[model samples]
Target: MPITARQLLQIFPNAGPVAGVFVPALNEAMARFKIEGRLRVASFLAQVGHESGQLRTVVENLNYSAEGLVKTWPNRFSRVSAAAVARKPEQIANIVYASRMGNGPAVTGDGWKYRGRGLIQVTGWVNYQACGSALGLDLLTKPELLEQPGYAALSAAWYWSKHGLNELSDAGHFLDIGSIINTGKTGTAPHGAAERKALYDRALQVLE
Candidate 1:
């Protein structure tokens, strides 16, 4: 009843231009993360499908400059800083300052760098570094590499293995995953609760 590689391929036939390559990598990561249960796998895949638009929009607005960089502070302001860091390095010349999202007037410092990536959409430099360390990758240097299917998949797996999907008890609470990935806000207003429940139901049907 579990979603097999074939079914996943069918579900996301057009998973970006590199579906052929990415799918295998995704499957491998899924297995490595032990995300085999039908419902759990479906839930995780569903989240990825929603976030990355089936891996088509990896760098959120096509901004892949800092694809693998981890954001220590992921506020809206930080997102502005991250954008600045990715663009005008001179503006925030110091790597330490730049890495910290800079104290520049242009940088928002509100924390938006924690957007989406991998299966769980791991966000923030701290998380990126943590995930990278877990997976043996240098996220600090090539944070944008998270856009790459191989690295993205591995990051997601690492997050799941560490956090455990059980933390996401309610299938309807997609924000839980979002929080895990984004680490921005808590579950104030539920978004994907019902839809997630429906998705879980569908997954259960397949399992049955």
Candidate 2:
């Protein structure tokens, strides 16, 4: 069943009017990606809800404080380096995301250009290229397109399906889903895991 705006709002009460705006797009994306059925839809919505901040934050916020940078990517930034780039979204992104995830050096600007965006936080050059190709959009040139309602939901669904999350949902591997979404790896404890599970449990009740 296509999820109703009411159901979405129930899952994300703070979503405000954007909840209705994304309903049709979400429904279409879920249908296209075969993210139907109660289990799949519930799981998909829970993750997307958490990732997007209830359909409000479609773009990744790179503005981090010095401590935040050190904590989030402890391996990447030292106190001195993080303090210099604190609150500098672009600079922080270029430096932290540089030379990884198919990004070029920070000087090349690929990291800032392809910073995480959309519902699923699609980051890096390769992901933009892949999601664009799958959705028939030139995301390399127009990476901000994912911030739009339709593309945000669609790209998120594409990522979910690509990672075989639908099957995981079917098997009730909800924790694995959170781990993959949060840490990009399975079996490890994910950040905000308790919150993700709470969202999932609430979503199941709503969808049921």
Candidate 3:
């Protein structure tokens, strides 16, 4: 069941500029990642839609206000700490992402260098290295490549396939899938689980 550019646009109307690129990338990725089943296709497209905001943004938004920081990363940005780094995406990325996700300490610049990118927001040095190796892109040297339309779709599909999301989709364990995709209280009812599920159903309507 190969998806067409027209069908893709039916679901994602704003994918105008990159439709020529995205449709082919997605079709290629489907074959590479074995996204064979209907559920897998719907789930994959739905998650990518939610994460990338209907294919509008490939990079993560790091510009956080003090209040946003406190709400988003309370542990990292206490009231006092949030104020200091408010509206500073680079500084916030350095502080909050420091020494984690295979990143170096705050002073090493690994945080900003490997900030979240691609359709699924691949974060950290380890992720870049692995996804890069899988895609043969040398992302460690040119992390910005993830922002490209083809690479963004490929990287996200790689991540989805690597994580065995197809199995989850087959088993109808969407909540478990959400847990893996995001950090939320429950695997099934995470922060954006409802929206993800809704989109999944919508995509299924089109894909089926």
Candidate 3 regions with alpha-carbon error over 4 angstroms: 14-16, 184-188
Off by over 4 Å in 2: none
Worst 10 residues of 3 by lDDT: 183-192
Best-first order by lDDT: 2, 3, 1
Q: Model 3, residue 192: displacement in angstroms?
A: 1.3
Worst 10 residues of 1 by lDDT: 102-111
Candidate closer to the true structure by lDDT (higher is better), 1 or 3: 3
Give a tens-digit lDDT track for model 2, residues 111-166: 89999898989999999999999999999999999989999999999999999999
Q: Give a tens-digit lDDT track for model 1, residues 110-180.
A: 12343345645665567777887888888766667787888887787677668766346335455576555
How much is 186 displaced in model 2, in angstroms? 1.4
CA lDDT scores, all candidates in order: 0.57, 0.92, 0.86
lDDT of model 2 at position 87 = 99
**Clash count (model 3, backbone only):** 1
